[model samples]
Target: MKVVYLPGPKSPLEIREIQDPQPGADQILIAIHYAGLNHRDLWMKLGQYGGKKEDLVLGSDGSGIVKEVGSAVDKKWIGKKVFVHAAQDWGPDKNAQGKQFTILGNPRQGTFAEYLAIEAQYVYEIPAYLDLKNAAAIPLAGVTAFRALFTRARLKPGQKVLIRGVGAGTALFALQFAIAENCAVYVTSGQDHKIDQAIALGAKGGVNYKNENWSTTLQEMAGQFDVIVDSAAGSEFGKLIELCNPGGTIVNFGGTAGAITNITAQRIYWKQLNILGTTMGNNEDFQNMLGFLERKKLEPIIDKVFPMSHAEDAFKRMEKSEQFGKILLEIKS
Candidate 1:
């Protein structure tokens, strides 16, 4: 099997031929057809993420056909199309991930390879409405967005939603999910064209955060938002606080921009706002996300798909933040 291996922190990713893995007694061997890229992969490449950084396959999302099953697994799963849940050992807590939790890739083998032997419980049948390529885009970002909006923020239909940094995968998923729930969705992006793209995808409106008065412009255009989902936590985070409706909720899952600064305590207390932080979710969140995707038939927007041999180009695109949606790797087809 050919795998994309990160030799060490800040080192370039390389393709290496490695032995294929056989399923353990509780595992299923999947011949991965497609894999999705995330900022997590980019961060690992840049030595920014914690964990075993050297000698690892880097990918969190994937979809494929089950080629074989472990002795303890049901034979019925063989030949079924499925996607792998990106997180493992999320434990029993519904509100937070336990200490045993770890995302796919890094310390464990991941889906970037031609084959993946994952536990049977962590794999789900791909919905009949979606193909393997798009299913490859769903696991990580979709679950994170679902947990952030529905589980953490407790988003409601007909409410107003503001998704920050709209072009990224997770943010786009949040936008799509919120809109599906009948919420009026708005967005922010560094690029104006991405804002237009969001509008085309059913967002009510959007603004470019690069503008000096972007938040003010959004407030004037869309009024206050009931739920604000942000990944780029930075100096402008305070502006998000000001844009929230009283008693509204703000959920954050990443800090790509930098440390949050200039936020005032009084604004939050006065508004009785809920400020929550979340990460990759528990099993329940993943299951709910799958159900939502099946119910809504929501398709992920794929910006580009690179062949396994061109994995470096995929990482470069993510490094420059040039993508409008999920970037994928065509592993088998």
Candidate 2:
């Protein structure tokens, strides 16, 4: 098996030939066809995220065909095309992950390889309309977006929603799902072209946050949003608070822009705003996300696809924040 893994702390991801894994009694061995890249993988490469320092395959999303099934697993799964869930051991809590929770691409092997041996319960059949390449793009970002909007924020049809940062995979998925729900979706981006691209993808409109008075301009253009989904929560996070409608919900999945220093507690209480934090979704969220995509026949927005040999370039694209959607690596047949 060929794998792209981190060799040590602060190490560059490298491709190496490694032994293939066999499935356990309740596991399935998948021949991975595609793997999706996320910012978490880049953070792991830079020793920022807490992934294992040695022998770690660094990817969270993948789609493939089940080549073999373990003794305890039903044989029907063999030869089925499926996508692997990003989280493991989500435990019994639908509201939050339990103590045993662990995301893929860390201490355990992940999808950046030709083969993956994952727990049977974590595998889901790919939707009829999705090929392996696009199915690989959905697991991490799709579920995160689903949980953030529908689960955490409880977004409703016809509500006004704003997603901060329009180009990343998760944000793009949020925009798509919001459109599917018939919400009025707006977005912010540092690049004008990104904002324009977002509008083409069914956004009502968007603004470039690089403008000096972007927050004010956004307010004038879209008014206060009923829901705000953010990944970047730096000093500018206060602007998100200002953009929210009274009783609005704001969900944060990551703080890519660093720590927030300016959100006012008074405004939150005065407006009765709901500020929530969410990470990867639970099993139910994953199932619902896939079902929604299948029912809607939604295809993931793929920015670019790189071969496994060029996985480092894919990481570079993510580091530069240059992609408009999920960046994928073609692993193997």
Candidate 3:
């Protein structure tokens, strides 16, 4: 097997030949076709992500064919096209993840390789509407967006929604899901072109947050949002609170900018806003996400695909925030 291995923090990614892995009793071996990159992978490369970092294969999203199954698994799975659920041991809780939960590509071997051995339970057959390339982009970002929008925010059709920092994969998913549900969707981005791209994808309108009065401009353009899906939480977070309609909900999943600061307590209390936090979801969320995609016939927006050998360039693109959608590694045909 040839794996993209990270030697250490700030180290260059190397493609190395290593021994193939055998599946455990409840596992299956997959001949990986493609892998998707996330901000988590970039953090892992910098040794900033929590958990063991060195000598790791870093990827959370993947799609491939089931090449072999362990003795306890059904042989019928062979040759099945599947995508791996990125999180493991999400346990019985539908509301939250359990103690044993861990994402792929950290302490555990991941999908950035020619093959991967994952628990059979975590592998789901790809929908007939999707190809392996797009399927590889959905597991992590899709589930997070689904859980944040539907599970945490309880967004409904006809409601007005805002997807903050709209260019990332998860934000784009939220925008698509909101539109599919018949909601009026808006977006914000630092780049003007990204805002236009969102508008092309069914967003009602958007504003570049780089402007000093971006939130005010958005409020005038689209009124107040009933629900806001956000990933970047920092100095600008307080502005989001002001943009929400009374009794509106804000569901946040990441703090990429930095610590949230200087939020006015009176605004939250007076408006009766709900501020909820979420992470990579449980099994139910993953299944629901897949079902939603299948039903809506949604396809992920792929910004670029690089060969496994050019993994460094892929990471560089992500590091520079140059990608407008999911970045993928072509692991195989």
Query: By TM-score, is 1 or 2 better?
Result: 1
lDDT of each: 0.94, 0.92, 0.93
Colliding residue pairs in candidate 2: none
Q: Candidate 2 vs. truth: CA RMSD?
A: 0.9
> lDDT tens string, model 3, 102-143?
999988889999999999989999999899999999999999
Would you estimate the TM-scores of all the predictions?
Answer: 0.99, 0.98, 0.99
Off by over 4 Å in 3: none
2 or 3, which is superior by lDDT? 3
Model 2 over residues 247-279: C-alpha lDDT tens digits?
Answer: 999999998889999778999899998999999
Give the worst 10-residue stretch by lDDT in candidate 2: 46-55
> Model 1 TM-score?
0.99
| Local accuracy of candidate 1 as per-residue lDDT tens digits, 57-132 | 9899999999999999999999999999988998887787789898999799888999999998899999999999
Candidate 1: the clashing residue pairs are none
Q: Evaluate residue 33 in candidate 2 and report its C-alpha lDDT on the 0 to 100 scale.
A: 96
Task: Give the clash count for each candidate.
Answer: 0, 0, 0
The CA root-mean-square deviation of candidate 3, after full C-alpha superposition on the true structure, stands at: 0.8
Total clashes, candidate 2? 0
